[model samples]
Target: MDTHTPASHEVKLSLQTDLTPAQAEILDNGAQQFLEKLVQRFASRVPQLLAARETRQAAIDAGTLPDFLPETAEIRNSEWKIQNIPTDLQDRRVEITGPVDRKMVINALNADVKVFMADFEDSFAPAWNEVLDGQRNLRDAVNGTIDYTNPENGKHYQLNDDPAVLICRVRGLHLPEKHLLWQGEAIPGCLFDFALYFYHNYQQLLAKGSGPYFYLPKLQAHQEAAWWSEVFSFTEDEFGLPRGTIKATVLIETLPAVFEMDEILYSLKEHIVGLNCGRWDYIFSYIKTLRNHPDRILPDRQVVTMEKPFLNAYSRLLVKTCHRRGAFAMGGMAAFIPSKDPERNEWVLNKIQTDKLLEANNGHDGTWVAHPGLASTAMAVFDGVLGERSNQLDISRSEDAPITAAELLAPCDGERTEDGMRHNIRVAVQYIEAWISGNGCVPIYGLMEDAATAEISRASIWQWIKHGKTLSNGQMVTKALFEQMLKEEMDVVKQEVGEARFAAGRYDEAAVLMSRLTTSDELVNFLTVPGYEYLS
Candidate 1:
């Protein structure tokens, strides 16, 4: 009998090999001495492979190791490490400026935030190259430099070297469009592009630990988190920073991550300084993951279940997980953006109260705001905490994108007019409506719905506005404008679509826009008025 072991390039002969008379004749003629050598070697080592197979089977049978992925990395508890200095809104709050030609950032910074984030991932309509360029601009923005002006009235963008704080949201992990953007421009990979962009552009702005960082998007799978950690940590090394020095905020937006929150935190605890629940994605997750389960659903989403027992429980768990672990459990966004019309703003005020009540019970330490208008509201609501002696972002208020409402509204003509504001608002509203009515498969005016379409209109449009879209109509909505718009539209949306019906885990019109709104400054200001004090 003859057996052979395969070389890296050659095939192996079987362990038990018997040659017929004709075969023996060929072998005798020396078909290949290599075959004989391989057979002898493999015969001697066969026992080792068999033992390995038996051990793996035994581990599975004993339920000690996963039948699959037994060799994967082991899970471990994570640590939190981000500097959080609490400052009053009046004392300090950074703004979001530039690109939009709006003073939203400067105003916000001057008005009520402890930190300002220049959004790129969910705001800009960065078709690949645009993303690269936008990021470079953001790098400049971080250092108190940006070619910016208020597009509406010809005001200039201004940032102080001593600005409160600045942060940015990069393209979510593995976003396919990033690849398209890079390749179309003859680059190899978007990830590489992003990392390089951060490196080369910040040549003059390098800080010992103060270089601009990121807000991660679409972070669901732990592997994805690990992948990003690797990329970020690697980038830090290449850029000449201390290992693990880069800080990030995680926007939990997928089904698996919501349910696996504990593990996700443990996986990212070390690098994650802040964790925010993403409402649109959270609802999307509920629909995508929990809706299928009959026992865990709400009677409908229209009933307002962001505070239901289940969500409350989950939120509490997230808050506890983050807080107990020393991480900042950041509350999700308040898309209602306060309204100018006090009545409508009052309604959002009602929602914000509910939102605040739920958040307070959970152990969250901070909330997000989308507009400068919301800054005052956030100040009023979080005044107690902001006024407190400790240093931390006030979690008492709230913080909070999107496709064309018409799916057909071209992004914008770059001109300025109040009508442009109406157009963009209408597009956002239409997008929310269409997504709710199941007309989400395609743009309201264009092509069929698929992954590409969803990404283009749904994801792309949202990012564009986030980055600060200029309208032909002359009106604008910026991260700074979010609060102002919320107040403006709160009444309009509620009055326009009365009593939205959501099936527990479904994304009704309200849920879809719950965290994606930016109407007119002053997000649900009612949260701080007498009856809303509990919101804080």
Candidate 2:
């Protein structure tokens, strides 16, 4: 369904759909020479990385417990810290994350936050148009020309003269950009996003006294960090930029990454900036990592808050580790999108304020907000704690008590309930429909749910059914039970969204896709893989 043709240069672009000249220009800007070089250098290495992932997954499937790498013990025990973080990346008190939709990009940059992580991963549904257009928007943003006009209200949006620091989050290592191929294989979406952005914007940003900053996603091993370091070095050499110009914040989203935190930091120390509390994916990863252990099954989604033993250990350990090693410790998203109801908005903002207060008190340098409206409320919390200080890396919270493996793997106590099961099914269906329709982040039940939360929702259902988890109502969760629950939830969704929009978004197909994911005999590593197949 994609067509290839030369565009503004010798390099051929695989065009999946027709593009306007301006859109084509964004793609063609430095795309020719840059993409060719990247494809030639990194194409062969994609398989090796993916194969390594499978090997680790196979071990998990076989009930092998992942531990700190023995070979990297020396690195972990060392007193070394990551290289100095840049000024712009130092005090990320509030970073708003979203897909690179034009309006979202404009609003996030002008949201008066410390940083804006323009996301190409969980927050985005990577259809071909979305990917290309996202790149264009980022370029335009860097150029200070990105803007949007609301067709409904005739309102215009643009960046502030002084905007938030921009940090781009590329696709995770596991995703493949099926639309683009090199050496007879689809290139890794991570590579495509990183290479294109660095190729086009590294020098441009450098001219403005900033550089290409990034948030690395879903890395399960330190080798992936090392691989990224090599890529950064390669980019610097190829582009004639200074070494260490590219700084990255790694999302400790996977369970294995939690155990290997020190090693991951050491591996990419020169290029590392911070460690983010990628709470949602970490929850999904916890379930997947311990899939073979029926005893490790989690409770209802609502009960698995960060205050739980396992989550608490993870957060405390991250802050301690990053601070001990002289790096910023970022907190997770407060996924509340302000509602239209004043009472609801006030309640949600108050909840976010308390959540952020915990992070700030725990010594997190910054936190994330889903909506622009919550930025002020979230920032007030961090600003109170971090008064006149860029970060609390000077505070050594680990000195009193260090985190142990047992604590990180501590089991939670709660009962699975019928309400929880139905909630997961409902969200899985609604979020998937939105994602399939090219909107990855959708607020349901007052929480901004993205692919990460959807993964948790669907994967929990699969795990519950696989382990025959019993609800509080004395009903055992089975495939048939889930199917029944799913149908009931579909009716709820239809009633909520009404007939026309639900049909337009193709919720029927999304329901079938979600059902397949939730009831499949084998677990799929990432739902986006299958979900993307239905796009375009």
Candidate 3:
């Protein structure tokens, strides 16, 4: 990648890829200066925090387990609450999320939901064009001029008069914006995503009586929360917006993050509204964070539902911590897509309702859905529990017993099956193929799968093989057994997708990558980190 420096900016901004006229407009002189300032001021600290994560992981690997921080006990025991949430965010009974594609932006915002999280993380593939185009799409959406025309069906899509409140989710700290560099190094991808969106849309959003709302992902500690708080403060000051003008909801996704929920909220209390249970990634984190614990090997990904002891404890603790601190306790994602068959669709709806009802009854203010078809079913569940209330923040679980570290780390009990192993191979391969092809959110086997779910699929298989676990049929999981299954599953995938489509797609490459990931001598922290090299 060659570097191009725009002569207009005093601060040196290096670009690895040539930008078109439209892309240049999005990164014009002012935006370039802002991004450069962010990079110089805070980008250096990202790696330090990331290193801290590794240090903690090493301790866990060396037989020490994560527990509440002794130093932050004062903060947790103190009485504090985050700033008042914006009126637009108070009634987030149902939020729909998808990538920032034009059609998805229009449809998701137009859907009958309270909020639409325009994702640049798990559901997005960070190809240069895709990233820049996503920013353009979001700009149009905020300006109320976004529309899409599908060439295949000759169908047009536009936002309705009353659309859902928009929240943007940036990439996590571990990823990089490979196309852009600051001081000859790639800037943090989160900064690139946040700076562009906020610069372009913050003014318009404020004019419309809303703020620059965000969903922060994959923070393993409260210090990471403090870093974001500083960024929000700096941006607000630079733009002359009032303090607390920016709001965020942190995803309590990682295992370490769950242990610091109160401290995380305190660190960003001036600019936070809540925390969400990013259940899929949390499960993947559980496996990766405890990779060496032989006794903690998880069973099939299908059997590891939220009802498990550890997951249930995590959920209850999140609600108790968030509501006690006067913030919303949001629930996890419902990833089921509606089926074409009437009976199948009914079954899907029933499953969605059951999952959402559990969240609502457990006192969550809102929940997430992947498809617009699921909004009403999830909304109905929340509606029944909330009535006219915007949230159930008052239902603090004070009477419940305190959740312990052992409970949170409890090994899940379930039987591993050959069918389950086969399913993981198929899903992981298909998802990786779609992702490398510049599509991250994919529909497979009647479910909306993203990078997080795919991570669980591959990581589960790796952990099982590492522990030499036996399946329900008494077949031991090994590298050789997995390789044989991989070959069989690829054949199944080829037969299902047909020879022509299979050949045209990246199935073979995906299969190769899957085999390497599952059989590698050491566990990969994130499949996306390695897989990103294959993206354009």
Candidate 4:
């Protein structure tokens, strides 16, 4: 496929395609390049506006969806116990409501690649207060305030480490309301000053001057990536932080993102961690994009398969693209974690393993773990993919790297201080608490579990951590290591507990009280693509 040789310093690339006569003629005339140049010129302003948004993003979550968006945190040194979370590859277990060591959580994560996203999005149903509460918990989780373990207790958050280690996917930037809008209002983002609003978003919040990271969703083009990159650059400049500290895990959710992967990846490579294939949105996008195609067909909502030929093609392309560029190639969402019915749960687990194997074999290094319960299992799959106990370190670009490979593999110390830990915990708690009352974690974790799942309960604990999380029962926790370890564990633990509670017949208390767990049926529902029903 790659007949072209690599330049001394450049990657060689080629595409194998059977083009029609008309397409061949356009290529000969360089029309594609001309069109691309035109697009870049026209799209410059769009990206500039997006960069402005990233520079000042705090204005968002004000319950006002800006016409535009800014885009898309951590802390360290304290005396939290190191015994509560994972620390080594062997510590795959996470404790709920009870105290465990952060070592265990780290072990679980490094042992496997399951990222425990403390969600205030799709995983929960959603109520206004719950949104607020979920945001608070997210802030706490980031800070490793283990006590935020229960928000009802009103504990303060305090953690240590870069919160980015615990990834988060926020609410989708869709219409304010689906079925209907107010007589005069007609939903948000339609008539809003999108560019200005978007500009102010990142500028305001990320300007806070430290730790900026996010998982961007619903992105659809290279133009969008460029816009976000500009915002990040501006925010870093204004905040006096290093450029690119604000890394993003961009989601290739819609059809356009998939087709334009080269562009998006090119635009944000320096700042992007990788691209994620959004399962539900991909199916929905296909339907919308191909609605006019007479030959293209789709299937019903319940039957998409990850192994379909088209999916296989899509996965292969993504993998090659990512690897060729020295970036991580992420797998698609494995929604359907273990369910209430053990049989269904086992089935889903098997399906997850199959999908994971496919992705790993195809060259994807990481996959999303939708719920806390699935974290350990997902990590197990990654272990198989990695084929060794050591971290998969990419070869350095130059010989002048600050740290040697041995140093990377060596045991180092990076803990959190009291103030730093408190700072991040505040952010995580604020995120989750805000979600409980505003948007809810379920909104973020939608594809993995049913909305209203108990992941909401963890919001309470995350809130408690917002206060100076004190673990006097019997452990000396350091805000430093726990900052990196147990901090992110709360999210996975919350979601897992939510599902467990729902199963244990505590629906009323677990799901209802955390009412922010639900979303309007329309928001959560999506139209399935015909002929592709087997690829979700």
- Would you list the C-alpha lDDT of every candidate in the order shown? 0.43, 0.85, 0.92, 0.41
Candidate 3 lDDT over residue span 393-496, tens digit each: 98999999999999999999998899999999999999999999999999999989999999999999999999998999999999999999999999999999
TM-score of each: 0.54, 0.96, 0.98, 0.49
Q: What is the full ranking by lDDT, best candidate first? A: 3, 2, 1, 4
Q: Mind giving the per-residue lDDT tens digits that candidate 4 earns over 256-335?
A: 46656656666776677666666656655444333333233332233345665555656666665554455556677665
> Model 2: runs farther than 4 Å from truth?
1-20
Q: Please report how far candidate 1 places residue 471 from its true position, in Å.
A: 37
Winner by TM-score between candidate 4 and candidate 1: 1
For model 2, residues 1-536, the per-residue Cα lDDT tens digits are 12222244565535445667866675564665567667777667767877998899898788777777788778878798888898777778889999899999999999969899999999899988888888989998998888899999999998889988889999987788877666556778898888777766776787787889999999988888888998888877666667888999999999999988888888898899989999999999998888878978899888898888999888898999898888889999988888899998889988998889988888888999989999999988888998898788887785657677778887778879899989888888888888888889888998889998999989988998898888999999999999998999898888888888777777888889988998999888899988888776
Candidate 1, residues 1-536, lDDT tens digits: the string is 12222234432232224445643443332222333332232223323433443464345334332211323323323444334322222232123321211244455444466666555444333333344444545445555565567568986767654554655565543322323222133111224334434543334434423544456765655555655566566555544655645566677765445444545555555455666666555554443332223222222123424655445544655565555445566666554466667887777677666665456445566566555555555545555544563323333222211111122111121233444333334344444444333222223222112121222222322333444544444444355454455446545545554545323313334323533433223222110011111111
Give the candidate order by descending TM-score.
3, 2, 1, 4
lDDT accuracy of residue 463 in candidate 1: 34
Badly placed stretches (over 4 Å) of model 4 are: 1-114, 120-128, 146-164, 172-210, 339-343, 389-536
- What TM-score would candidate 2 get against the native? 0.96
Ten-residue stretch with the least lDDT total in model 3: 1-10
**Against the true structure, candidate 1 has what lDDT?**
0.43
